[model samples]
Target chain A: MRIFGLRKNTMQEELKHNGLYSRSRQALLLLACFLLITFLASFCLGRYGVPLDELIKIILSKLFPIEQSWTSQMETVVFNIRLPRILMACLVGCCLSVAGVSYQGVFQNPMAAPDILGASSGAAFGAALAILNSASNRMITVSAFIFSLITVCIVYFIGQRAPGHRVVNLILAGIMVSSLFSAGTSYIKLVADPTNQLPEITYWLMGSLSGTRMSSIGFVIIPMLLGLIPLFLLRWQLNVLTLGDDEARTMGINTNLLRFVIIICSTLITAASVSVSGMIGWVGLVIPHLCRKIVGGNYKYLMPATIIVGATFLLIVDNFSRNLMATEIPIGILTAFIGAPFFIYLITRKEKML
Target chain B: MSLTTQNLSFSYGIHPVLSGLNFSVEPGQLVSVLGPNGVGKSTLFRCMLGLLSGYSGRIMLNGLEISSFSVRELAHRIAYIPQSHGQSFNYTVFDMVLMGTTHQFTPFASPKKRQIDAAQMALEQLGIESLSKKSFCCISGGEQQLVLIARALAQQASIFLMDEPTANLDYGNQSRVLDCVKQLSQNGYTILLSTHNPQHALFYSDTILALHGGTIAAFGVPDDVMDESLIRLLYGMEVEFMDAGKTRLIVPAQGRGDLCFVGSHR
Candidate 1:
């Protein structure tokens, strides 16, 4: 009843008026519970399997000392290995989903994602070049970050005409830029040392959190979190922006300025995520949409819910990647496998993704 | 505040759309910009609102240079309603109308209670408060236009600039919107509206600016701009005016080269 108090009343009112089953409250609660359960399942089951009871004990031991034989090794698995991976999954999930929501609003297109604007391809190319040059790990991430920023700047410069009427044109420009960078990546792969660089690049493209460490997570968390903060603060403005340029302008918004700020912020968050974790697609395209189906389109509710659902979805995927077979699978592969069918379902709905 | 554009010249790239266009409307005055299509009416309005730059002249709000005002300052002074805008997604009528309050509310804040009350009042002013919960895209063209007008009203600006306010409305709805415009004028709001229908201009507007090929061919009262030879030269059709008591009617002559009044005269 507490969970359903304000939200259920709003949903009932929305349903009475809109008549389209405004189950935003019900859907959000269900998603929250499912995400929590999934997160717990992710922690409990992995290649180095800790049973649910053991997992609970491990969690509790951090709070209160529990004398056990499995303490040291359990600490290593939970704190050293799994914690960083879970946190990385959470960071990437929040980055991608928030970026997706922002991109959709900026372009006024339901299907927009970070990759559409060449952020993923540019980061992949940067990392590939770094690997080819035998660069340091930090340099590789730095290069990816810079290149993603460059890609966004180029796309915005080419697509903008006059002011904030760049919705359709901007997406078209992003598609063109994305293809160009993808072609560059292919060329780099072709000429690279096949035994070492080619394999590394290929694996990076497939994406995995296997290599994620606390240090690497530290490198990404600060920048992505900083960039995400502004986005959360401006969520309502983003919603107002989706009403089209004229309406937004009429509302006394300097729409062009708002567009520029949002693009830079979301791009930074996206580029930082890709730099650390490699090319993880579909989470950006799919998670925010799934959240929208549950939380309605208001960013106040949608942003937090999308972050939670996305983190849970990816953490579960990361767990499956490690434990599904004898060899660790790439997170991207699992996402595509699951996302394709769900995306197909979304496409068949009355309002297909623009 | 009164709105005026003095010797306002605006061009898109090589071709000029409005040149040396001088016009004025006092506070509480309702003026119409009536001309054939592509006569630079919207361009003129855009220049006045500072939506378009690179113009070679001046637009003044209450005798203050429009160029001196920031976008927010201009928005607070004047509200513009576009001819017809596309809704790519579903937003409720209340949400749509509430957008006009963005000037007063920060991006971090939702509209306050007072703002919501103002929006509801604006909707009621247009007699469509019941439709506030409906999807904006689901409404009829006239209803959408009214909602748009309501949004402009919610801005609480003293001046209104509307492009083709009656284009999508039927006769009855057109009259209703015009009546709303009339009421706004009576309530001490200044209005500048663009329309293709000269009859609407004659009926609702005190001043008419006849635009021809990017320049003001004629300007003044409706009767003055609606002259016989000037209308023929501007629209390439013979036209005449007939006085019926207090009302003057604009009637286009039936055949070519026959600028004669065929209607009953008072």
Candidate 2:
């Protein structure tokens, strides 16, 4: 019996040794290359159209005092405008994707996303309110960030107090809170001046990167890093969390504490992303699924892969948003358009690996 | 390691599940907990693993109170095998088994090379190394149960608490799992498993603990505790024992007037 088992084992061992790591490595390399290409394309394919060689020269000149061969307007577009927007796109993408992955694991639900905790609706309400009051751009961003955090906290507290399964309760609580804030947003929109505030409210709710500035980068960077770093460090624990609360507890994890930490971290990154990017959807919901298709479900590989793939995916989508139409389409619209169909395809596929 | 529970009792608001239960298992013993449905066998196992609290009892592991042990310490000493169920994510068999080594890993660190080797060794011990690369959700039910056992083995704990380990298996698979449990016991690993089948207790376990009406109805060696009277009382069915060569077979008893012959007259 042992001999027969061992004979079969040799075949499996051969496949295991050859199949897993090599495939994962190849996927990682491919994603990295795609990210690089997308980043360069986003920089060069914009309206002003900086050439690839000049783009490289400008980036190099920043570190060292190279000859200023490019025009100063080109310099402003590269450093002051396009560079920050590109970087912010990458950051927001990474943030939402990581948060989505974490939420899915914690809830053990495939449909879970970062906005499940009412963050987007709450942030939209805050942005709408600020727009109604004629607040400054910075004030609007801050209000949105603060309100999103508040909404998540309320959902979490209500969920904890509710009976039945924790995941179900949290989801139900989220729906309630989300609807409340969404109503609040609608009320604000109804009261605002239709000629002035209506279009601005509509634009922010639709989501875009037009308002991304170098000044706002500092505000988002600190919180995004603060949230992302802890999540990356705690990736292994998140794997255990996916096993359900009772199983994780048996394995010596403090499930409640780990869950609390994960929620806070994921919330911080999500709120930061929404404040800057204004309710962009689909990247959070779809990118992790796409990454799982590439790297499999082990969070050790899945988390980093989600980060890279998400950044690349959003940058490509943002490019299309700006360049596809004469007027800039909202980033959120493009993501939903791309994300919804791909998600349908994933579900309809027979393999159903997830 | 020895496990002893003294006066363990638990209730859910107005309804009591386990009441004043006292039991102990010696090292290297295979003990079967026999009970009807909803007799709190799983709850008792949970209490043993410190997964459930608010039970008034002293649970001692090798003479130390279980309450004194931290979650990590308890995890190192006792491993739990929950009933196998489908997962939302389809983790590979190796990844599933690697989770047993979580207690050994420091916070913020992934499983190292040594841990992976241990997980591999566990699969090999269970003769399941060939299934290491397969997706867990796609595997057969028996294979899934074995993977769960392999995961417990990877924890390297001396005591194992399993809840209905073979509840969903066919007869052949059930025997295979019982054989594994028997082998583990011979290798000096203490095990306590809950089951509805008294025959499994008769054939495999050294000690049978029969629970009824929120307490232990019988506790002794299988021969002492598993008589026709106890079987009838526990399951509400009359039974008779027949000798077949050297082994005893249990069969349900029929009423005297119900017998009839339909074959041709001889």
Candidate 3:
């Protein structure tokens, strides 16, 4: 039966009449375009510069075998070093941003981020331990990912034990767990060899995509996709989740189960991102807020918007990180330098909403 | 769906909240639960919604035990509207209303086109379609309450349990909400709302359920159940009923020398 068709048409008509709807649609399109432009620009503007035209031709030549005019060195730089790094930046950005948005919704706290459950700190410690033992790069990534998940699981169990106010309990438990892991990370650094192992550990903790390889990208991509698909599909349920536990439960949602699933998925994404790219912070926390300004806080649109915006944001920041100096600055340092001020501006301008 | 509770009792550890509360609501009836603060009004509503377990009694929805129904089944039959409060996010009114359709879709599925249409129709039913694009946080308290009601409407449930729906609203908003409640009852929706104001119960409700000291102090038609003595017993304050043409107004009774007129020189 066509019972709901009439109302659907009317709703569409009303939505078209409303300017915000079209504006948001345009904003999403603009973000998608921005992401593409930034991605290509990131590939072309690295230290070993490949012109935009050459970059495009190289990309197209992969699909269609055209005679290469550029030197093989240029091709190697474009394909081997810059491409994987750019892709890793995009993947890590996408992962952290989606995880942040989910954490905020699940906690019903705008200030929440992926690190709230000590995932990053725990991952850092794991990477440090692996480096201390002279493990392979892949082993370090694996250990980091596993430790991040374990840390969040520990925080969740601790939070569940507290009596009242589940959200508050979880936040408090997260802080305690985070501090505990942070101390462990500090201890690992203190005992490592001063010249080599210490510097490596410190650099990893600072977070970078300097040594990213195609192999490491494969490790992250599967877990990231596995985590993101559920979040994207269940964005509507995430909205109900933000309404608080009691209301969501009454709305026929299994709040505890949904919360557990969201936590696990978000932790997987965050852990994978941190393992591949080290400890990039603020992307998860700030990207979602920026997207909220664009998309008006509906997770249905906000989730996908966060993915695009975050990927684009980190790509732009990474471009600056590499090109702004002779020595490549850590992307984490650049993000914090940029993210904190931008966040301050957002807060001061929209104080009432905050 | 009709709702009935027989010999319902609930306690929190050593403290009892509701005890031996018996009440039945027919379809298309507007019942107002009246009590002072901490009188188990909200507790009773939670019990009815199956939010609180370990309560001993037989609470039935359409002759089916409430405990037998899953959370989703209960949601299909009954919707709960807690007191309106600020949200952590500034969701659009349309998005806020769309949340009511959560129960209709699977956990991994987004709300489809039909559910969106249901939310829009709900907004139209409440006569707030123009506010669809506005931020829910930006709206007035009254408008927010109406949006919440629209959300409940979108749920397509037969029974509504509201806990102090108009508690924080201004006088005009309170009247508007009460009017909406009356209209819903007239349209064959069973509604049970709790309030501290007995006048709302007097003017709007078909039946009054007065809870006092963890028990049902009074229950019946409003006219038969509400009286000066009952108000005194419920709130520990003496009151006088004044005739207002066809309706009655409640006023606090004055003790000796309690009523004094102060003149302004200006």
Q: Pick the candidate with the highest lDDT.
A: 3
lDDT (0 to 1) per candidate: 0.80, 0.88, 0.89
TM-score of each: 0.87, 0.95, 0.95
The lDDT of model 3 is 0.89
Stretches of candidate 3 off by over 4 Å are A1-20, B256-266
Could you tell me the lDDT of residue B222 within candidate 1? 77
For candidate 3, lDDT tens digit of each residue in A1-67? 4869875676775564455467777889999998988888887786677888888888899899988
Q: State residue A341's C-alpha deviation in candidate 2, in Å.
A: 0.9
Model 2 segments more than 4 A misplaced = A1-19, B256-266
Query: DockQ of every model listed?
Result: 0.29, 0.49, 0.62
> What value does the lDDT take at residue A193 in candidate 2?
99
Write the residue-wise lDDT of candidate 3 on B1-266 in tens digits. 78999999999999999999888999999999999899898889888898898899889988889989888778888898878889989888988888988899888888776777788888889899899889888999999999999999988899999988988999999999999989999999999999989999999999999999999899999989899989989988788999999889998888834433455343
Which pairs of residues collide in model 2?
Answer: none
RMSD (CA, angstroms), candidate 2: 4.2
Q: List the residue pairs that clash in candidate 1.
A: none
TM-score of chain A of 2: 0.93
Candidate number with the higher TM-score (1 or 3): 3
